[model samples]
Target: MDAQQWRIDVDREVCAGTGLCVGTAAGRLRLDAGRARPVREVVEPDQAVVDAAETCPMEAITVRSLTTGEVLAPEL
Candidate 1:
């Protein structure tokens, strides 16, 4: 069987902690003291996660595939 791979990152320095990620991808992200924290280093996020990452004003959140190390999106 193939291993499932995933990755989620947040730049605390850049994160505004708007709660957007937590609201959008509750299963993958949560608010921790006003900061967005990934439930795990590797996550299988849905469209919501993608949207949150894309819409983050600070461009702090990053989503990627763990196995491939492909950055799904980077902060702009």
Candidate 2:
């Protein structure tokens, strides 16, 4: 994985299964079993993923910078 790759996580407990993330980034996220999950945990930097995180109604999605461990989405 590249140092600048993005890491995606979804808090199942906090997720409302609204599928907003999936709609925002279908290739990067999915709604499954009443929760959202990343299609892949680590992926190349993608704006769609960030949008997905930001669009999540429950704020269940989190995107991070793999190398710096910085929270990249949901704006804190």
Name the top TM-score candidate.
Answer: 2
- For residues 2-74, could you state the per-residue lDDT of candidate 1 as single tens digits? 2456678888877888988787777888878888888886765467777878888888888887777777775
TM-score versus the correct structure, for each prediction:
0.81, 0.94
**lDDT tens readout by residue for model 2, 1-76:** 5788989999999999988888889789988898989999999989999998888888998999998889999897
lDDT (Cα atoms) of all candidates against the true structure: 0.77, 0.90
Model 1 residue 49 CA deviation (Å) reads 1.5
Model 1 clash pairs?
none
Candidate 1 RMSD computed on C-alpha atoms after optimal superposition onto the true structure: 2.2
lDDT of 2 at 33: 95
Best by lDDT: 2
Deviating ranges (above 4 Å) for candidate 2: none
